[model samples]
Target: MSFFIRGRRRDVKEKKGKKRGLKNKQVLPVKKSKFDSGLDEEITSDEEEEYLKGKVNDIAEKEAEDVETAQEKKVRLAREYIQELRKERENEDDEELDDKAVAARLQEEVLESAGKLRRLVAETFLEPVSEDFIVLKSKHQKLPITCLTVTNDGKFIFSGSKDCSIVKYSIEGKRLGHIPGGRKGTENLHTGHTSHIYSLAVSSDGRFLASGDKGGIIHIWDGETLKHLKKFKSHRDAVSALAFRHSSHTLYSASYDRMVMVWDLDTMAFVEHLGGHQDAITGIDSLARESCITSGGRDQSVIVYVIAEDKQLRFVSPHESVDGVKLVDERTFVTFGQEGSLGIWTTLKKRPHHMIKRAHGCQAENGLPNWICSATTLVNTDLVASGSMDGHVRLWKITVDRGHRKLEPLFSIPIPGVVNALAFTSNGSHLIIGIGQEHKLGRWFKDKKAKNSIVVVSMKKNV
Candidate 1:
C-alpha cells in the first residue's frame, strides 16, 4: 500500500513540472528548445526572471501600438503627403524642361529655313480694316482707359482706367477679371486703386503684375491669380509710369515727383531711387538690359537710367515736353512730345539721331500741331506707332540707310478717340490701344465724339 501511494505522488509531480516548462517556452521564445528538452530539467532563478521580463515587454509593445495617439497618426500622414507633393513638383519640372527643349528646336528650324526669305516688315501685314479690330469695353471702367499692358506670351491684357479700376481680358476679348476701385478715403481697403491708375506692367515670366496710380501708390499682384501681393509708397506725387525688366522681377517706376524708383519683386522691397529728371516722368520702358529709358515731362529730356553703373544718360529732345518714350533696341529709342514732334534717339548721342517735326500734322480747327501723347515700338523691329488726338494712330517704319535711321510713314488707322497708350505683343502679332475722351495726364482736352475703350488690332503675317 505504501509503494502504490508513492507512485501516484511521483506522477503528479512530473505533470506539474511539464506545465511549468510549457509556460516558460510561451513567454521566452528563444528558450523554447531548452524548455522542451525534459520536464525533469529545472529552470534557474535568472532564467525565470528573464521569462517574466520578456512577457512584460511583449505586452507593452502591443499596448503601445494599439494606443497610438491622434497626433502621432497625423504626423505620419503629413509626412506621406509632403513626399507626394515633392514628387509631383519634380515631375512638372521635368515636363517643363522637355517642352522648352522642343520649342527651342522648333524656333531654330524656323530661323534657319527663313534665312533666305525677305526681311519681314510690319507695314505689309498690319493693314486692318475697321471690322478687323476687337474692341473691349467694361461697365466697371466707365472712365477713359489710361494705360494698357500685354503679357509676354500674348495671352492676356491688363487695362487701367481713370475710374481707378483695372480690367483683365484674354486675347480673345473675353473679360476674365475686374478689380473695382474704391472711394478716395478707402485706401486702406487694398482691393483696387483709389485714384487714377496711370500705368500697368507685367513681368516677362508672368509672375508679377504691377500698377501705378496717380496718388503715387504702386500695387503688385500675382500674375496668375491677380491677387494683391504688395504695395509701395515712396513717390510723393503721381506715379506716371511702371516697367519690368525683361526675364526678371526687377521693377522700375517713374513718378511726377521727378523720381524713379527700383523695386525687387522677389524680396518685395524697394531697391533704390534714381534722380535725373527735372520734371515729372511721363513714360518709362525697359528690356533685357539692367537699364530703363524715361521721358521727362516738361523737362525736354530723354534719360536712360543705367542701373548697374548708377549713371543717367540724358538726351535732349527737340520737342518741348517729351511726353512718351520707347526703346527700339538696346541702344536706340523713340520719343514723342506735347509739341507734336517725334524723335528717334540713341544712347551714344546727346541729341536725337532723327527728328520728325509735326509728325501727326496740325489740327484743322486751331491750326496747331497735334500733340503726340503716346508712342511704342515693336521690340527689336523697325516698326513704331504713335498716338494722339489727330484722328488717326499712325504707324511708321524705321529705315536704316547706310548707318542712318529715319522714320517713314507706313499707314494710318483711324481711331476716333484720344489714343492714350499703345502696346505691341511680344511677337508683333497684335497692337493694343487705350483710347479715352480725355487725356491721360489730365482733362487738358476732351473728345466728345470719341469713346472710352480698349482696341485690339490683329495683324496677320504676310506670307
Candidate 2:
C-alpha cells in the first residue's frame, strides 16, 4: 500500500510540471520567463503592444502641456509689456508743462474764481452787469475810423481810416506814427494805401502790421520800426479784412474782388487764392488751427474752406447778409449781418447754432433792423460784443441751454457816433472801440465831428 501511494504522488508531480512548462512557452521568446519568479519581466505580444501605446500617449501629453505652458508665459509677458507702455504714456502726458501752460493754468484759476463771483452776485441780487467799464483814454481821428486792431501785448493800437491812412497810438493814446497814404513815392513812410485803409491786422508777436486798402493793396510794416516791409496787389476791389495766423508768419486777406488770398510772411509771396463766394467777400477770419478759413460776404452766405484740401467744407446762408465773421474758439464762431442779426456757428453744423435777431438795440427809419458793422469776442471769456450803425455797442453773454448755445443781452453802451469796429485786449482787460459818423451818400450828420474817435475802455481793471 506504501509503494502504490508513492508512485501516485510522483505522477501528480510530473503532470503539474508539464502544465507549468506549457504556460512558460507561451510567455517566453527564447529564454525562461521571469513570470515564474513573479517579477512580470516577460509579457505576451498583445500586452507588449499595449504598454508601448501607453508610453507614447504619456510622452505626447507631456509635450502638449509644455507647449501650452510656453504660450501662456508669452501671453503673460505681452500683457505686462502693454501695461508698462500705457503707464509710460500717461506719465508723459501728465508732465508736459511749460511756461505757457503755467500761465494758462493760473489764468484759468483766476477766471474760475471770477466766474464764481459773478454767478454769486447775479444770484444774490439779480442785478445787471454794471457799466462795469471806465473810459481809460479817448483819441480823435482826422478821418472816419473804419477798422482798428490792438496789439496782443496791449502796448500799441492801430487805427485805419477812410482818409487813406493808418495811425499808430500807444495804449495811453499818445500818437506813435502816421503811415502815409499811397504806395507811390514816400520812402520815409510805409507804403500806405492810395485809397482808404479799411482793414488792419497785427502779428501775434506784435512785430508785424498789415494794412489793406480800398484799392486792394496790402502793406506790411515792421510794428516796432514802423517801416515798410513790402507792398502787394491783393485784389481788384477793396480789401475788406486782413488776419494773421497765430504764432505763424502766414496772413490772409479778404477782398471785395470775391477772393481770399493767403500769403507767406517769411517769403513775402502769395501762397494761394481761395474763391467760392459769388459776391464781394466782406469778412474773413482764421481758425486757431490755421488750416481753415471762415468767410462771409454780401452773397448772403458764409463759407468755411480748408486750405490744404482747397475745398469748401461748409456753405450756408443764415437768411441775412453777413458783414462780419469772427472765430471765438475752435468749435464756435460769431457772425454779424447787415440787418443787425448776430448768429453763432459751429464747425460740426452748416447752420447757425444760435441766432440773436435784432441784436442791435435800435431800428432804422425804413422800419428795418440797423446794420451790424463789426463783432468781436472777449479773450478767455464767453462775452461777445457787437457794434452797430445806430451808435450803440451791445454785449452778449454766451450760455448753453439744452445743449444749444444762446446769446443773452448783457448790456449796451450808447456812444456819440456809429461804431465801426470793436476789439479787445489779449488779456481781456480792455476794450478798444472805433467810432465814426454814419454818412449817407456824402451827407454829414449832427455829430460828424464827434465821430471818428478811438475809445479805450478799462474792463476788469476798473471792475
Candidate 3:
C-alpha cells in the first residue's frame, strides 16, 4: 500500500466581511485569447499563474461551502429527529408489553441514526463560528473563586482561592466576607500558595465547610463563623478529590497517590485507604449505604468502588472499564474520551441497559486535534458536558445505571474552549466552564444559538 502520492492539509480561514458565494462570483475565467499564439511564453506568465491560483481557490471555496451547507442540513435533521422522539413518547404508555425492550429499541435506533451523521459535519472552526453566550444571573464575587462548594440548602456557596483565603458567598457568587479562616494577615494574602486551594465541599446541613489545597492539606472550617475547625494532613500526594459523607459523619479524600482514604468527619480521624486501583483516583461521590468513585490515570481505566460491610472498599460487583466516569445519580453516569464516543451508562439493575454513542459533532479526521476531556455533569446534575482540545465544548443529555454502571447519552451539541472544569449554577440553567489555555471561565447553555434565543426567552425568567 505504499502509494507515492503527497498530501498536506492546509487550514483556510474564511475571508472576513465576504458574503456567501462572493468568492465564486469573483472567479471570472481567463479568456481563450490570453493563452493565444500572439503572446510569448514569458509574456504575462505571472498574470496567468495568479489567475490559475484564483481558479483553484474558487473551486476549493465552493467545495467548502457545499460541505458547510450539508452540515447545517444534518444538524437540522437531527433536531427534527429529536423533536419526533419527544412526540413519540408524548402519548405512549409505560406499561406496554415490555418497557425495557421499548427503551432499548428506541435507544438503538437513535444511536444508529446519530452514527449516520458522522460524515455530515466539517469540524474546521477553531472557535465555534456560531459561538454565543446566554447570560444568566451571575454572582460577581470580590475574591476570585478558585473552587466552589455548594451547600445542600442550595442557598450558600463557599469558595477557596489562590488569594490564600476562603470566603462564603450566595448562589449568585457574592462575597459573604471573612470567616475565622479568612486570609488573616493582609500583607500575606497575596504572598503565599498557602491557600492555593484546589477543591471545596460543604456538609449537608451547611454547618461545616472544607477546602483542600496543593499543600497536601485539607482544612475543615466552620461554615458560619469561617474559622479553621480542623486540618488533616491526609496524603503525601496532592489532594485531588474530597467530599463529606454527611449522613454518617465520614470524610473522603482521593489523592494522586492512587488511594481514597475514609476519615471520621466527627472525630477528624483517619479511617481506611481504599486501594485496589493502579492509578490516581480522580473523583469520588457517595450514594446511600454505598460510596461511588472514579480512579483513572495514564493507564486509561475508570473503576467504580463501593464500601464493603467490613468498612473496606471494593470494586462494584461488575468491573467496568470507562475512559472517564462521573456519577450524577445513583443509577446514571456519563463517560467520554473514546469511540466517536460520548456514552451515557444506565446501570439500574446491575447491568448497562442503555449505551448510546453519538458521533455527530466530533472533530474532523483530516487535521484537527481530536483530544476530548472528561465529561462533567452540570445544569441540574443531569446535563453532561465536555470540551475537546480542538476548542469545541459539547453538551449531552445523559442517564446512568446505579447497579450495573451503564451510561447513555440522549442528545449532544458543541460548546467553546477546552473545558478543564465544569461547575453548575445554583439553578441548572447556566454552567461555568474553566478553559485550559485561557484560564478564564465561559458559560454554556443547552441551545445551539443561545444569545438571541436566551435573551428573548429568558429576559423575564430568572435562571
In order, the Cα lDDT scores of the candidates are 0.86, 0.72, 0.51
What tens digits encode model 2's per-residue C-alpha lDDT throughout 262-335? 99998899999888888888887763455545566667787777676666766576565777788766566788
Q: Relative to the unseen true structure, what is the C-alpha lDDT of residue 444 in candidate 2, on a scale of 0 to 100? A: 39
RMSD of each: 17.0, 23.0, 30.9
List runs of model 2 lying over 4 Å from the truth: 1-140, 182-190, 439-449, 461-463
Candidate 1 wrongly placed segments (more than 4 Å): 1-120
Pitting candidate 1 against candidate 2, the one with the higher TM-score is: 1
Whole-model lDDT for model 1 versus the true structure?
0.86
lDDT of candidate 2 at residue 141, scale 0 to 100: 44
Residue 106 in model 1: lDDT: 49
Query: After aligning candidate 1 to the native by TM-score, how far in Å is the CA of 392 from where it should be?
Result: 0.8
TM-score of 2: 0.69
Please rank every candidate by lDDT, starting with the best.
1, 2, 3
- Using TM-score as the yardstick, the better of models 2 and 3 is 2
- Over 1-463, each residue of candidate 3 has an lDDT whose tens digit, in order, gives 2333222111122333253446454566766665576454564778999978998999999997777776788888767765565555644565453445555656755553332111111121122222234322222222223345566666665555444455565545455755323343432343323645666777777777777766667777777877667777768876766777644567778777877778776787788877766776555655344565564544455555657653432323222334445655554555554343555544433333445443334455553334444456642244555654444555554432443323333433344334344554434434444333322122221222221100001101212
- Global local distance difference test of model 2: 0.72
Could you give me the TM-score of model 1 versus the true structure? 0.75
lDDT of 3: 0.51
Structure candidate 2, residue pairs in collision? 182-193
**lDDT digits (tens) for residues 1-463 of candidate 1:** 6999999999998798887776543443455566566644688999889977998999999999899798999788766754554454544667666556555554653453332112347667757887779999999888999999999999999999998998999988999998888889989855878999999999998899999998999999987888989888899999999999987899999999999999999999999999988898888999877899898989888888888888888888766788888988777789888778898776767877789989999989888999888889887778899999988999998887775778989889899989999998988889999999999878978999988999999876667
